[model samples]
Target: MTAQKKCPVCGKPAEIEFRPFCSKRCADVDLGRWFNESYVVPEPIDPETVIADDGEGDETIH
Candidate 1:
């Protein structure tokens, strides 16, 4: 049998609707961590890769 996926936050069995998270609460908690800057990328941002948006160009980053 395949092992069930667990939620990253609470170690609960992940649901299909929530994928990696067990419930909406867990998903919200993850989102809150991101919003609160509790989670972060370890790599430092490279200044050469950044684009300055002066609103003078039509190129959207996303």
Candidate 2:
């Protein structure tokens, strides 16, 4: 049998509609965290990489 997933915000059993969260309130709370900058996605870029804008408004690696 598959184990039920718990809500990341409140540690409650996740509901089918919410999928990963228990309720709309929990979902909204998670969104609020993202808007408030509490959650961030990491982006790594190489400093040696150079991108130049072509005349046609497209970016090209020079």
Candidate 3:
């Protein structure tokens, strides 16, 4: 029995030539998006309260 692999982009079955990707077009599209920084993982941010320690603290040196 052969193991099945899913495409990294569309979650479809990956083709042998593309290995992790289903097709050359999909792989290229993903590469282009990554190069352009258009594909990003969504992160949640809170706008109300600000945390102090983001390296902008005023230090009093003796």
lDDT (Cα, tens digit) per residue for candidate 3, span 14-50? 9989978999988997899887785564555656444
Candidate 3's clash total is 0
Weakest ten-residue segment in model 3 by summed lDDT: 43-52
Candidate 2 minimal-lDDT segment of 10 residues: 46-55
**What's the lDDT for all of these models?**
0.85, 0.81, 0.79
lDDT of 1 at 45: 88
What is the overall TM-score of model 3 with all chains considered together?
0.52
Model 3 residue 24 CA deviation in Å: 0.7
lDDT of 1 by residue, 1-62 (tens): 75789999899999989978999999999989888785566677877667665678765656
Q: Give candidate 2 misplaced runs (Cα > 4 Å).
A: 38-62
* Top-TM-score candidate index: 2
